[model samples]
Target: MNYQPSQNDIVNEYIENLSAEIAPLFLEIRACILEAGPEFNESIKWKNCLVYGTTKNHIQTVVGKGKISLIFHDGVAIEDAYGLLEGDGKKARTVRITSPDFNRAALQDYVRQILQRS
Candidate 1:
């Protein structure tokens, strides 16, 4: 798929090296986030994590053994109507994806809300 022009090469490498077990789910989540907010750019942060944003970081992707965690940087401000967001940190919330059939609608909603806020 044609992604945004701002896509970073380093982030591309990171996604390319993802384990077979989580790559599909990670790609799906990446597609969902990009589709929901086409203006966002991708980059690798903290040496390993993939982060998405416009001018500043908004969402962070953390890969785990068998799951992927999407961390909304300003998640505290986004509406959680679907109750999919987790965490009680000062400003971040996470959505854990473990399977291919994750909640796309809710994920898209969160992405849109973050875009609107930005």
Candidate 2:
């Protein structure tokens, strides 16, 4: 697979294709983050999707050329506060995977807490 990404760019055109399968889910996820607080900002970062909190970025999609990666950033660094969210990154402090499966409530809880703490 060949990919050409400009410096500091994460959302390539490839990621836009995921909107068909991931946008609906992404909307739900965004809602969850918004419900957490008013500080979180939903914007396109790295040309991909990103949810920004005041102190730090809360969530950002890692969807790449042929794979998707959703990182929880500092939120996942919290000890077992990810609302029983399941994924390859379950064990790691932060989540790094290429799947659309996510625990909406758990993810919401995570955003809420991180925004509160940060």
Candidate 3:
């Protein structure tokens, strides 16, 4: 039989190997999502920070040169009363954090809202 690693395992390894500066931000965003509820799961699929729960491919993260991107796969279905979400795609949206001092409370709130929509 062939052996293949699970997505969770891949993501864990990715996180473990992240650069010093990017790792904390990655962790912080992860923690924010996890705190929303116990329904979410994550993995490193498509070489991006992929999250699942409520729906497959529900969320994803991209670590760019100097920014981190939080992507909502079905963002069109969620409420963004604060107008924080960016993107105009038919089905997706994104929020970007450019610095280490990004707002935690707001992020948590956004995560909570997204998770609750599940």
Q: Give the top-scoring candidate (lDDT).
A: 1
TM-score per model over all chains: 0.92, 0.56, 0.78
State in Å the error of residue 4, model 3: 24
Write candidate 1's Cα lDDT for 29-63 as tens digits.
88889999888888888869988999889999999
Candidate 3 lDDT tens digits, 1-118: 1122235777667776777777777676676667764567766677565565656667788887767898887787777776778999998888898766777776666677667666
By summed lDDT, the worst window of 10 consecutive residues in model 2 runs over: 1-10
Query: Judged by TM-score, which candidate is best?
Result: 1
Model 3 TM-score, all chains together:
0.78
| Residue pairs with backbone atoms closer than 3 Å in model 3 (clashes) | none
Better candidate number, 1 or 3, judged by lDDT: 1
Total residue pair clashes for candidate 2: 6
Model 3: lDDT to the true structure: 0.70
lDDT of 1 at 53: 90
Q: Sorted by TM-score, highest first, which candidate order results?
A: 1, 3, 2
lDDT of each residue in 47-71, candidate 2, tens digit only: 5456454666666765445344446
Rate residue 71 of model 1 by lDDT: 94
Model 2 / residue 107 / CA error / Å: 1.2
Candidate 1 deviation (Cα RMSD): 2.2
Q: Which stretches of candidate 2 lie over 4 Å from their true place?
A: 1-18, 64-69, 81-92, 95-102
